[model samples]
Target: MNTSAFFEKRVGWTKYTMLLVLLVISFILDLIISIPTLTTTPKLGGIRGTSSVQVPSSDRIGMERVEIGIGIGASEGCMWYGKDDRQCRYTLSFQPSSEFLHLPPKQNVTKHFPDGQIMATCHINTALQAMVTTSFIFGPFFAGLLPFTMILLPITVFMSIFSAISLLIASGQVAYHLKYSIPSFELQWGINSILPFVVVFLQLVLSIYIGTLRCMMRKKNPPPPDMTDEVRLEERPRDNTLG
Candidate 1:
């Protein structure tokens, strides 16, 4: 059985099946990365007697109090509240300190003390909405039209490109924050923030492959003859036989 013949016989169902599988996998990965997790290192400062704060996942965006742990002193734990200049303060062992500093988004904030400074790092996980939209909305939309290869192929390719670009921008934003702002913070690519980028790239590759397969199938299987032409040809053969 020739490989091309095998694919041609089933109307390129194999390609469509593979496309669906890729889209599903991509959607899952996109969804997974959208969840808030500890994408960066908890400890931020390197100086002795400096406290290291671990901002919990929940406090990244909301007005909730962020729990902080001190590496030095006998203080058990502290909590940070608010991002405003005066509101950004932490209480360590019931000792209130107003030296807490807020940095730009995706960067770690710092707390000043006489001994040393403590840093709290967190990234804005804004890609969640985009990833979710791409995965749940656009992905399924294209997958549903897979049976119509002529329509599906171009749409898939276009969607794949669009999603890939969007993901790239998101990944770049995360990486920029991780690199320049968060000191001593290490971001795990596969586990933390790089999942969407990888998934989108995979989707793009799959879309291209599906598009190629679609073109090949089209070439192999010619379009059906026009109904009127087919009818005319059939009638001419019958008329000749009768004559």
Candidate 2:
């Protein structure tokens, strides 16, 4: 069988197309996480604190409950009077993590000033940076190119594996710091933290499956049966008929 034909036939276009879809989803999710503008409320919360700032609406001073948004690179937060009401004119500023990705790292929300305003700063780490960079590189640009060029199978596999492992390490670091390092803040984790892992997992699965299929196809196809000797032996039957 023709190598290209066999590849298309055996693997089927549907699965390959699915790979593209998955990569697209992964890239979008990555972008969603990397941008600091959007904040998602987790079903389970993280790093909760109370500030006795005066309520914006009324002179009645009440304890404002603040919760840090759980995120991979950066997070935004909201202040609440109670579970039902939001404090007015609230602003949560996250110190930018790195100029490279422009995402704020794991946040530390503190009230050090006399005004009772929460100052949020990034605790930047290498692992978080790695995750962001990996997503940017492997997400859209490479994903678009991969479907056209089948030669990149091995490279994609290696990159996906590296990305998954690095993300795992980064996630562990974030979890450890949140649990032990910040005792004063109540830690709550939400969908933001888990979404990146989902992306990595999808990439890993796609890369490995496609790579393995390519390898197996190569072994089965076997290089056109080496016709050198057969060509040489094709005799001069025409000469015998003429004689």
Candidate 3:
């Protein structure tokens, strides 16, 4: 099926899939490209973490949480690093230590200094930086762009569709639409129930990463948004048929 018509005809089915593929492709492209900001390490310094924790290898893609520790310095902020070649707000871990530090002690809260969550964030963020930066650099060269729109167009279109589908599936599994249990992941709940929420947030970030690559690839000029919808009837044409 032709591309534009395929979109028009199966728009509903394609909606989520479209988003997914875009994200995957962006992640891939981000991995490929080293344009400018690939060299810097996302400044995740002095992020108080458990001094030592077991980092087990699992089928699960991102870094896994191991232990809990304390919170210290610069309570809340954002940073970007490595080469995810992805976009915006840098890394994606929730600041549990930040919150725990800020919060006053309630009855049963077990607030540990440099806890597992902190350790987990550190590992996940650093690893992700590497993955994303690598992907960004790879994307552009993988589908090299010359003046010839014919080859580029098919590559862009096909990659968009394929990557989007893959992304959707990957993200759906992350999003909890399709349930597959990871035993270790299950154990993380003892530390914090909201850990999965962090996963969803990171997945969304990955989705956005793929989208960035697609935007870089395509060419279009979208019209400005129409802004005259809220005018009152009395504001104009007060007289009947005032031609």
Candidate 4:
């Protein structure tokens, strides 16, 4: 007896799943990092304390106080001397990490501190905005449709490249803003900044690989031609048996 077999053709599913997961990770990280109140640690305070030789209690009065130029913003106050009683005061301020990227640069913030002191500066640049938009919109959209079709593979590759470039530029902008705008506090880059680069690289490499595989698969096993049900039935071989 002889048997007929049909072998179904398919692409690499492991790599495809990896690419989807990578894009999803990028989307999540981007969304989390964009939050306005998100802040990272290792922030250096502006104040520096000095040690003095042991002295009388009376002489130690006001010795611990160090003069630092503190910026004050609107809707906040300094509680230096006392809540009610007041003395010469300065405002200590620190803003969240995301505010450095989202807010407009030209906004007046005044408090009970010296005037003209620069607080946190927030300016969203094109690269940063692009990266954010890609992560929130493009990343998820591409990831969602990737498993179903190969048409978006090439576009995903390009989007990954664009996202990587935008992320690099955004990192530079954030670093610059942190270094110059608010030098008082030293903010360190956490996982939020680092993981996106890795995700982007994986996405780029996986998409390119998958796209190449797709091309190869197409060349190896061309898609079957479209046909009507009647034609398909007519093409089917009829079995004949003799008893």
Q: After best superposition, candidate 4 residue 213: deviation in angstroms?
A: 2.7
Q: Model 2 off-target regions past 4 Å?
A: 1-6, 37-57, 60-93, 96-184, 217-243
Among these predictions, the greatest lDDT belongs to 2
TM-score of each: 0.37, 0.43, 0.20, 0.42
**Which scores higher on TM-score, 1 or 4?**
4
lDDT of 4 by residue, 58-124 (tens): 4666533222222112112221211222222322133332222222244222111132112211112
* Native-to-model Cα distance after best TM-score fit, residue 209 in candidate 4, in Å: 2.0
Give candidate 3's error at residue 115 in angstroms.
Answer: 2.8
The TM-score ranking, best first, is 2, 4, 1, 3
Deviation in Å, model 3, residue 95 alpha carbon: 20
Q: Per-residue lDDT tens digits of candidate 3, residues 14-82? A: 453554454445434333321212123222222222222233336666554333232221112122212
The better candidate by TM-score, 2 or 3, is: 2
| Candidates ranked, most accurate by lDDT first | 2, 1, 4, 3
Q: Compared to the true structure, candidate 4 yields what TM-score? A: 0.42
lDDT of 2 at 58: 39
Colliding pairs, model 1: none
RMSD of each: 13.5, 11.0, 19.7, 11.7
Q: For candidate 1, lDDT tens digit of each residue in 2-111?
A: 33333546445555556667666765654443332221221321111222334345646744333222221111223233322222122122232324422224435232
lDDT, residue 118, model 4: 26
Weakest 10 consecutive residues of candidate 1 by summed lDDT = 116-125
Residue pairs in collision within model 4: 73-110, 74-110
Off by over 4 Å in 4: 1-8, 12-19, 33-183, 220-237
